[model samples]
Target: MIFSSQHLLFSSLLLTGTIMSISSTSWFMAWMGLELNLMSFVPLITSKTNQYPSEAALKYFLVQALGSALIILSAPLMMDMDIFSPMLLMALLLKLGAAPFHSWFPSIMEGLNWPQCILLMTIQKIAPIFLISHLVTQTSIPEFVTFSSILSALVGSLGGLNQTSLRKILAFSSINHLSWMLIAMLLSDYSWLIYFFFYSIISASIVIFFNLQQYFFFSQLFSNPLTSFTKSFMSSFALLSLGGLPPFSGFIPKWIIIEAMAYNHMFLPLLVLIFSALITLYYYLRIAVLSLLLMTTKTKLLSPFPAQFFASYLTPSFLFFNMFGLLVPSFFLFF
Candidate 1:
């Protein structure tokens, strides 16, 4: 938890597990890698001092174990029987926390610290999603994934509408983004990867900002009078970027995916995705507007502390990227 030796060991194993799963040539090896990944993550999430983490660890273990069991069970049968492909797909979707199977995600996120939450949202998803991409090429899997994507978009957008906890909001946001990535996966091999790369950067930046401020809820953003105008503005901008607002880098990948979807004539899913995106942007705007528009009398220009200093310096780079990063793709395209 403190980046000590034990943490280092487990973290290394965690990465090893993901690499193994993604790179493995056989189902058995992949399953073993997933198990190793699961085992390594449990220790990282568990803590003696905190009860919530322990409870979270248990829930995470159980859910992941069930998914792993399904994977192992279905993997052997997949070659001989077509039905097993859906079973295997379901297992991966469960692991990815794609909706309908996503009930466990928000609760687990609530119990994690920001660092662990970042891992859960980003790195932990890589292997399962890669496996899903592989599986999508099989018969009947696309329809299933399509339905799950639509459901994930709807559930993720609707579920976050009333949440106050920052973690829960992020959890739902991850789910919504997963819907987009799922659609991207069906469209092309690399579109989801592109979307995920941008998503990870934006999500990590937002969470890191929250971690720096020790903010766990919306109320804290408003209550902390020492919050600076620069910090507030950056935070709002990051949230908007995450919500996929135009002119921000976050919207770039979504725009690419939208273009591809249009070319494919997938109008219905496109409409649903766009509408759900609007809902997601609404909540993000809610947070950003309240934090940016409401004036605080005791706002500080800068805080004389090491943490604030680090954050203050780091924020400008992120702000610059969010503001101008949309130009990057075009720069490559035209020139």
Candidate 2:
């Protein structure tokens, strides 16, 4: 009972901070809201009594702290300048898990169990990205943001290539998604919102799907594979969908963003972006293929599900978001 209440309170505070960040006009107020969001989430990261929890909590806290400090220090400059602060904006990128400053993402993801990672990867991302988009008009963020977007996509795709840990692969995938998100950031304000909504759903769905499986490590994919064809096919679809292959909701945002990029005539940038997509697809396909080696004598067939903290939160919730994104694309045409 105590644990339940604590969880409620923490979540409430974090959410309150997120909304406040969105609504705030004062740079200071937005900064405070970010701090509030960060502090609230720290407890969640450390809530579990495990080594990974403690380490993840520390990494998350330190990265956030550094990012927050940069924003706060730059606050005074922007106040007098009328122009949006580039440093503060860059700091926001770090906080949002964009590249160059993205080293923390995979490590932190490595430390958390999947549920926490899911939340961190999805809903938790909403606040910072929201604040960043809000501040875009105050500065010449388009070019700088564009560069970061490409970097994030390149790094994410390359980083995941030979990864053997499930968490690390998802971590890299999250980074790749951030690259697309940064592009959305440059295109339109609504684009960011649309990207966030869909991205969160897709990420949460993928994480939930992964959480249901037996293996935790990436190399373990072939070690013990799913014997049930239903489970195997569903999991494969989820990964493929994550790759933004057609028919699934995952492809919806990619289609929109690519179209949006083309409309903007960002030809060279688009070329770079497509290449990164290919790199990401390569790694994702590798995992899917390995998981299929379930029947081979070289690897063990899977066993029963182990009780995990994130498993419950992932289900139904994931199913809802996964399907929701598929339908939400209709609204974009009018925009």
**Which numbered prediction scores highest in TM-score against the true structure?**
1
In model 2, the worst 10-residue window by lDDT is 295-304
The C-alpha TM-scores of every prediction are 0.94, 0.86
Collision pairs in model 2: 164-218
Per-model CA lDDT versus the true structure:
0.91, 0.77
Q: What is the TM-score of candidate 2?
A: 0.86
> What tens digits encode model 2's per-residue C-alpha lDDT throughout 157-232?
9999888888898889889988888888778877767766776767666776667664578655555533443345
lDDT for model 2 comes to: 0.77
Candidate 2 off by > 4 Å? 1-3, 82-84, 225-227, 293-335
Poorest lDDT segment (10 consecutive residues) of candidate 1: 296-305
RMSD of every prediction: 2.6, 4.9
Residue pairs of candidate 1 with colliding backbone atoms:
none
User: Which tens-of-lDDT digit does each residue in 1-335 have in candidate 1?
Assistant: 38899999999999999999999999899998899999999999998999998999999999999999999999999879988899999999999999889999999999998989999999999999989998888999999999999999999999999999999999999999999999999999889999999899899999998998999998999988677777888899999999999989899999999999999999999999999999999999999998887643343434443366454666877777777665676778776
